[model samples]
Target: MTLLELLDYASVFVFALTGALVASRAQLDIVGFAFVAALTATGGGTVRDVILDRNPVFWVAEPGFIAVAVAASAVVFFSAHLLESRLRVLTWLDALALAVAVPAGTGVAMTLGHGAAVVLLMGVATGCLGGLMRDVVCNEVPLVLKQGELYVTAAFAGAAAALVAAQVMPQGAALLVCAAVTLVLRAGSLLFGWQLPVYRSRPPRR
Candidate 1:
């Protein structure tokens, strides 16, 4: 497969793995695990495709992607006891999936003649929304909404980089640059607790 194609499949698998991991952490049953895994694997890309009017969506068209999601959920369901800590692994997998997906989403959107705003939106959705859904379904606060580190912001930053680089470089180079930026920004946030400001509530009026 070509590099972009490879990255796309890798993103799918990593996302599936992380999704299943989250479900496992929640002590979900087999069907629940599968539901979460499939949702987390395809939710973001489905949203992007729907918005961009892309046909059939990726997972719907690719049976292998569904197989991968099912297999990932199965593994997690049966092997949860083997994991020493699910959260750490899920976080790392999420970072890796975002690095793979941000550029792919932006590049695909731009290739289809989407404007910069649309490209950025697609990239952010592709990079973060699946994990956000996973967290929510697992009864954890979505990371993007938490007063923690800059999660979705990193996706936006990388999408901005891709939007600019695609204007100068070829699609491949732009994808690489965007992916690199996303990886660096996200990993830094995780490692350093680099959070965006959380608005504080005002005091009660008299």
Candidate 2:
């Protein structure tokens, strides 16, 4: 299989794992596990595909994606208690998944001859929207909405790096660079609490 395809599947599995983790935390049943897993796994890619005018969507065209998500849900379902902190694992895993998904999305856009703007936007969407959907459905504040977190910024950096590197390297090399940049920045954020500065408005004519 191609590296891009492998990245896609890996993203699906990791995102689905996060979804299942959230479901377990919510005390949801097996059915809910499956539902959340599948939704979080495919939601971002589906949105990206739609925006890019790729018909049939990804999961619809490839049922194996859904199968992978289901398998992830099952794995988490049976093994959640083994982890010391599901929430911490979910956060880190989601970051890793974003590292993969951003390149997958950017590569697709690059292959389609899209401009850098579209490539960057698609990468951020693919990296972030799934987790956003998962958190919203779970009634939790989405990480992207949180102050100071570098989630979307990491995605943008990766996507932009991929697009720039594609001008001088093979697509696979570009994807690797993308994933590396994303992983490093995201891991740094987690490890050292790195964050963007928040905006604070001054009082109006006090």
Candidate 3:
């Protein structure tokens, strides 16, 4: 299997796990777990494929992706109760998924011979949109907008790093750089309280 496909599988499994953990927090039924899992696993890739005009969406072309999502959901459904803090686990898993998905999208765009701008955009979209969908559906605040905790910023920087790395390294090595950069930035935010400054409006002067 190609590196891109392997990246997709890794991201799908991790993202689906986060989605099922969210379902557990919501006290959703088993069917709801599956629904959220598939949604979170495929949402970003589906958008990327549609925008890129790929002939078949990734999960549609290979239904094994959905099988992976289902398996993740089933496992989490039964095991989520054992976690003392599902939210914490979900956030870390989401970070890992983001790292994998960003490079997957960047690699796909690079393989298609798109310019740097498209590659960067695809990377951010693929890394952020799935978790955004999962959080919104679960009525949780989307992590991408969670007080500037470096989610989209990490994706952008990672993709940009990959683009730069491609000049001096093989494609696989470039993607590894992408994943490493993404994970480091995200993990810093989660572990060290790293944050981008938020704008605060001044009170109206009379």
lDDT of 3 by residue, 1-206 (tens): 99999999999999999999999989999989999999999999999999999979999899999999999999999998898898899999999999999999999999999999999999999999999999898899898888869899999999999999999999999999999999999999999988788776886578
lDDT (C-alpha) at residue 201 in model 1: 90
Which stretches in model 1 have alpha-carbon errors above 4 Å?
202-206
Error of 3 at 125 (Å): 0.2
- Which pairs clash in the backbone of model 1? none
lDDT of 3: 0.95
Runs of candidate 2 with Cα error greater than 4 angstroms are 203-206
The lDDT ranking, best first, is 3, 2, 1
**Highest lDDT against the true fold, candidate:** 3
Deviation from truth (RMSD, Å), model 2:
2.0
lDDT of each: 0.82, 0.91, 0.95
- Residue by residue across 1-206, what tens digits does model 1's lDDT show? 66655666777788888888887777778988888888888888888888888898877777787888888889878887897888888888889899888877887798888888888998998888888888887888776665667778888999899878878988888888888989898899899988776666986578
Superposed by TM-score, candidate 3 places the C-alpha of residue 158 at a distance from the truth, in angstroms, of 0.5
**lDDT of model number 2:** 0.91
